[model samples]
Target: MKNSLKLVLAVVLCVFLAGVAGFADEYILGIGFTIFMYIALAQSWVVLSGLTGYISLGHVVFFGSGAYVFILIWGLVPVWLGVFCSGIVVGLVSLIVGYPVLRVRGPYFVILSFGLAELVKNLVLINEARMYVSMRPVFGAPALYQLYTAMLLLAIIATGLTYWIRRSRFGAGLRSIREDEEAAETIGVPVAKLKLLAFAISGVIPAMVGAIFIMRSGIFQSGDAFTPIVSFTMVTMAIIGGSDDAPGPFLGVVFLVLLQELLWVNWPEVYMIILGILLLGFVLFIPNGIYGWLSEKYFGNKKNVT
Candidate 1:
């Protein structure tokens, strides 16, 4: 418990320092917002895929939904209220959608989740979906400042929430489920209930991230929201950084964002191919993720040799 607290504090400190430094610079601040979104995405993915062993590939469903709501409602309502509403809407919808879907296991589950993203994307395009039915872009840079502040606050809160989840009884139950669902169920875990809760929570984070992204980018296309690549990249971030620990998401965001900035524009196709190869390498060589690897090698796996 002490170690976990220390770890959480360290993450907070690092994020705060990073945030402060970003505020100090001009160009870096823009990059800071991007990094913050990735953190939210990677962390949300870890909560569901990492803790529960449910590899959801349609996280964009919640995210895009939120972006649309923010676009449509931001001017009509308080931006914060719009943000919260979007998350709640998507989270509830995820619960409804996940009801039957969560029962499946392994490859089929992954396929279904991945497919939902495409389904949502097509729906948006065909329907002429307005991410912001009435979103008129602000005339200048002042708007960007407000948007950035909102994103920063949301990012910090989301990270803190993950820390709380990691310490809660629900989190412990999730760890058990990840370890062995059958045994966890037999031992009094409300497996379905806990899973639904996690799914709902997981859905909310991305929704908030989406809202911020749309607000800042001023472009909330459904294609942008429902991209399978978004889900894949998020999962890759979590898996490569260390799915077993909270710090893994933070580390994953930093690593992948840097890689994206450095190589994505120059070699878009090659970038994805390299990402795929990196993921394969992590699964095979660093099963525990980079953080997991570091933990075992440095501090040693004191959790017992499972």
Candidate 2:
């Protein structure tokens, strides 16, 4: 009952933010959109990496694929339909990729995931060059509003799904796999299937968000779509906020987005350096992240209170 109320309040808050964006200055709306976008992306990353303890350096593969797929199909269908289809396609891709890749554990899995993303990016670049693929920049108030609302919805869905998984039997299985994969399997956790399912679920939202984001931006490029920086940013957000907790990624996104905006405005040249220092400090001192630290300090155990 408490969780349900929290979810309801969150939804109401997002809707209220949307309503405010409708009347706010374009700059403010843009900031809101960026924040929501990162929240969705970070949460999606957390779904698999946080829950299953598989760090994927190439999760941007789905994001880029969705953006490209949306561009490919947008002209033939409604924009909304195109975005949905893009997510389905990306989720299917994750299932196929996860089957073989999930067999490898630890750093090898992370490296393979990164390789796959690079491969996808190269393929996209080659295709764009060969076919002269290009998109005209989209603009206007209506497009912005649509993008903002879609992003907000994606964030909400991702957060709700994380909350559900954290409390479900399936979530417990994933947590076990994270702690000890072989032990999980020995205990009949069906590690392989659960990991793949989690991976697929993690893929879908980011893909949908990518499609919506590209549509809003009005232009798409292979480089931007497949950038490893995005994947890194999501991972950083999840880690910095507390990857073990459902609310960690969201909190991390909120802090990072605001920090980024401030840095970009005042110290763009040194922002990356500052970010690196902060990340290093977190790794050395608060490895479990802010959420984990706070939970330990106040509640003793996040699972109990959450």
Candidate 3:
């Protein structure tokens, strides 16, 4: 489909979903919230990893760190303010660390990203132990509808950011760097600057996503907060959605999350097995993912993000 039509559909869908949040039962609302949360996370990943071809295997570090930051100051401030602060803190830290980390390329950078997340997780774990802090149930979180609304807003922000960036000169430069860093730099692209900026941009929303997610769960554990599966799911959604443009992550997240929900309900014993099969099927048959495949079928290699 054309970008214009896709944008229209997205806006309509967002409006419809927003309208439903007010009347949907708690279970359905929770599902919608999870979907929006993943949408935000996936689009945020696309800002850096998808556009720049710098696949991040440890994106959950920001998520977990954001959760930790918010948990530490949970009752000390307004919840929304705490979520905002988490994003700000994570963004700044990523900017500082991204400078040196962005120097690596290829598989090495991937390994570094994964290792960095693990290191942060262990440090948090050790710190928690030292403080003798046991996991405590969260109390007095904001209303469910309030969190759902906030998360929906975040999803919109992340989706719009990716969409805008994908067609802008900056996004073009990032894609160029993705294709060939040395060649992009030879042509005057500020490779380091764009990568760092994208890296920082990618970190912010997920941090907020993590903060809100913890509030939803009403308890925090370092292990669950920093789990690698979060990273895996984000990457998988982007890949499955064909992170070539604005609508891809939304499609990917909805499909996977809904599929998982159904499978878990009916085939709990083999839900993961079915998911693995689906992932593998996408990898083998629909390599470009659902959006990419659709574009190819309808546009015949005609679609371009720019």
Candidate 4:
């Protein structure tokens, strides 16, 4: 409990310090939000894939659904409150979706999740009037800066929640299930319930993040909210940074986002393609990822010697 508390306090301090330090430079400040956004996204994926070992390829479905919910509610309520509600709505939606989807495992599970994502996109396209901004009149919205801060706070809270879960009894169940579902079931892990909870929690982060993305980016279109690349990038960033552990996603977001900025000016495709290749190579050569590699090379040996 003490360790967990310390971890939470440390995370809060890091986020507060980073936000304060970047306040002076507008460009760098924007990067801070971007980093937080990806961190939230990657960490959510960690809950589903890393802890649960469920490799959901279509995670954007939850994210887009949340954004759509926010859009539907924004005119009637405050954006912050709307975003908060969107998280719950998304969590429920994922639970409903996961009931049937989570029954399958491995590649089939991946395909079903992908299908869910497509289903979300198609639903958004067909129900654009009901799901998007065109249905309602635009009113006064909060300033983008305020919205960004709201998003940063949401990200911080979400990260803390993830950290909490990682050290709790629920996290242990997830780790056991990840090791072997059949064994987990035999050991009375309540496999289905645990997975549902993970999926539901994972869904909340993306949904809330989607709300922030739409409000800040000024793009109400579902495409922006439900981009496949967004999902892919989140997963890749987690893997590249080491989604199996907490620091992995943070490191992954920092390194990849920087690389992304560098590529935005020159050959963006090259950036993504190279990143994909590097991800594949990492999986093959450095199974633990960059952090894992560094740990093994230095701390790992020391721990062994001790």
Candidate 1 TM-score, true structure as reference: 0.86
TM-score of 3: 0.95
Quick one: best lDDT, which candidate? 3
Task: Record all residue pairs in model 4 with backbone atoms less than 3 Å apart, i.e. clashing.
Answer: none
Poorly placed runs, candidate 2 (over 4 Å):
1-5, 134-142, 302-306
RMSD of each: 3.4, 2.0, 1.6, 3.5
Cα lDDT of model 3 by residue, 113-159, tens digit: 99989999999999999999767467999888888989999999999
Candidate 2 TM-score, C-alpha based: 0.94
User: Model 1, 1-306: lDDT tens per residue?
Assistant: 487798798678766755575345655667777887878888888788888888888777778878876766767777778788998888988899888888887788889888887887787776664443422352222355455566666666666677677777888898888889999999999999988888888889899888877766667677776777778778888888887657778788889888887777789878878877888998998877777777788877732232
Q: Relative to the true structure, how large is the alpha-carbon lDDT of every model?
A: 0.77, 0.85, 0.90, 0.79
> Worst 10-residue stretch by lDDT in candidate 1?
133-142
Query: What TM-score against the true fold does each predicted structure earn?
Result: 0.86, 0.94, 0.95, 0.88
Q: Considering lDDT, where higher is better, how would the candidates rank from best to worst?
A: 3, 2, 4, 1
**Candidate 3 backbone collisions, by pair:** none
CA shift of 269, model 3, Å: 1.8
Model 4 worst lDDT run, 10 consecutive residues: 297-306
lDDT of 4 at 42: 86
